[model samples]
Target: MTTSTPSTPSTMRAIASYRGLPVDDPDSLQDIEVPVPQLRPRDVLVRVRAVSVNPVDAKVRSGLAPTDEPRILGFDAAGVVEAVGPEVTTLAAGDEVWYAGDITRPGTNAEFHAVDERIVARKPVSLNWAEAAAMPLTTITAWETLFDRFALTADSTGTLLALGAAGGVGSILIQLAMELTGVRVLASAGRPESQAWVRQLGADGVVDHHDLVASAGEVASDGVDFLFSPHSKGNIEAFARIVRPFGHITAIDEPEGLDLLPLKSKSIAWHWELMFTRTTYQTADMAEQGKLLETVAGLVDDKRIRTTLTKTLPDFSAAGLREAHRLVESGRTTGKVVVTR
Candidate 1:
């Protein structure tokens, strides 16, 4: 573990796990006092006001094995800057910010968390802490999926099919595709409620994922130019059939295994979008994420895109974190669920 000369109070409240445990177990998450994190040269210390739970949170928590130290699990957070490292010039103490913090570090499930300034952005002024917290992880995933991984341009014209269109990433992706590109988006929903939700988010059309072939054919006779499959485990064959020759396919979920050989005949391209890649690898362009998030904040302020925070838990506690994890793991949530301080 890394240590630094103390410059702040020693301990703060946090929810964490010292070993892997099932979500249903009471001890799966516990309240504890941890030393306030010390900062790196490019880091910012945030006083977390709110945090939003995602599938990644549950996945990481459950996969944790026994270790000497407890692991804090959270990614999406909105907070005020409590401190900044010497090299962090973009922000200072007292600035309100939001970020999808690095997965390699202690997370936002604490009263105070330190994150690299390169991936943090100013919070959207029009949104409250909970609302702002809901956007970072999902927004970064959706943005990189459409524009970065797929290399889509504003003038590109085609049909896009988005599977699981009511989930956090899908909900935001549907809106961004409509607002940022010329593509006609055809979102797939399994339930009527999800269908209505995607339409409300401005999908050009909605289709039942069960009858993907027929539903997608109605929208694009020649097949969709792009397929965005957030849940791709059982839908790869369907995607290959409905996607046009030479089209692109992108996914974010952890499918068991993919057989890409089937896509060869049509010369289709497939890409994976993991938003954590940039920060995890410390890429040369990591700072681009902060700039892009700033752009997203501006879009929110202009009302061109809206926050997808559909639910908010009362406060950051063991009970609240457990419930949030259960809701996300249920796989029925329509948008984002947040826990406020």
Candidate 2:
């Protein structure tokens, strides 16, 4: 085996997995030591203080196969910068920051991690580390789905329906639509508690997915102008019935299959929003993520939006990570779940 250089620092603790296993399996996550990452020219090294769990984490972990190297899994993080690469100009040691790290590389489940500077932004001053950590991944997903995929603007006036509004992405999307745009929002939630939660987030009305058509029709007689489906893929026919002709539908879930034939009659526009696409493809506008995070930080500081963190584990240990993943996989979580060092 290759040895570390004499001057290189030793390993850092991380919660990682060696093979795909069910969330309840003890072997699904383990505490281990990993060598500190070396930085690329556009990279910034962060001393991670907090991280949040999401559906993608569980999905990716469930599909991961055994390998010699363990896979660290976490996307959203808040931390202090420990070092910067030569080409990294916007951040430096001691700078407080938050980011949704690129999915194409090792993630933020370590004591320290390196991330591209173009995808990071200063953390919101109004929130603590865990709260800040909870926002990035979900914020990026909601923001991109609303503005990039739907092409919505502040002046836009129409009804926007959010399916599964009690989850992280939906909670934030409801607030974004209410605070940043003139659109009327109709949020769908199956449970009474979830319905109340979305209403607290400023949803103009709440609908039940089981009674979707009737409940949605009560909100918008002319049909909703946009549908943000974070869940409820089985309700596509209801979506077709309630959405206006040429209305836009955006989603982030990985349903087994979606048939567009139902939507063809209305000429509905369908769009998929995967927040990692920019960093995964190294897109030309990857820096736009940093800019958007800065905007979100400003919104949070101004009280225009709030962090959606509803649960936080005690520490950044393997047990903590596993518990967080279990809560995410449970499907009953109302908001975000975080782990802090």
Candidate 3:
């Protein structure tokens, strides 16, 4: 997303990609200039303080740029509100906020960004900018998956096997499930470091993801009640075997061309969640994101949940943004990487 016309009288520094090139390529990311966007009714313009890089940033950058204009690629950010649109009432200038902005809009990589107030919330008073920036996107993904899709509650009881349990979403998902519900949590991690990471985060049990059936079965002989896999491309068969009959499975990755026939026999229901869904679809419950974020902020301030910021890259330069993408693409990160202004 780019702006050809200045809605306001100013322009801002931003990192944008003119084309989808490899991360090692010099021109893959460039420091560029863009207009401070005109506010749509209900839009809140923010002075971005810090932004975090997720897998989506690398995935989007590897694809073709959407148009002739440079694409600004980022999702999660922490910032202060500079202005609000004509119809806005929930927030005003000088309010500190955090959000995973709409994927269809110009992203949070810029010095300034505009987002709908309905999906934005007040930042946690306890965290710094980098810490606040790292939580929104991954936290929202885990929150929506557990509450909105799976509908897990305090009274619910079952075993949840989390595949890819060391990544950003799983790191927080384990915390939320452990903190809020009585479910038995089994985390799948392949490496010693990743396993130790999840254990410290309070996973009830940790199993190696390789040979998930054998490993997870040792802990959950009756089969898991719920399965959450962040990487679901080639593991659907294993997912089918480990989950009990009538069990529920949810995934965030686009596991294109993977067969679901294995799941039909047991009547296992598979669901997909994109945290951006409500905002993009313009659903009546779109405002739920802001409310849930407020809840997560309360959790953070009270020290019940924590930010997953593992790495930090200073400044919003081409070098820093490129390294952030490289770390996300490497698939070796335990938590999230952030770039601070």
For all candidates, the clash counts are: 0, 0, 0
Scanning candidate 2 in windows of ten residues, the lowest lDDT window is 1-10
- The lDDT, on a scale of 0 to 1, for candidate 1 is 0.90
**Cα lDDT of model 3 by residue, 52-131, tens digit:** 99998898898955467988889899998888888888998889999999988889999899999999999999999999
Candidate 1 lDDT over residue span 304-341, tens digit each: 99999999998699999999999999988999999999
TM-score each candidate.
0.96, 0.96, 0.96
Candidate 2: list runs displaced more than 4 Å: 1-9
C-alpha local distance difference test of each model: 0.90, 0.90, 0.90
lDDT of 3: 0.90
lDDT value, residue 184 of candidate 3: 93
Model 2 TM-score, 2 decimals: 0.96
Q: Model 2: which residue pairs collide?
A: none
Model 3: per-residue Cα lDDT at residue 190: 91
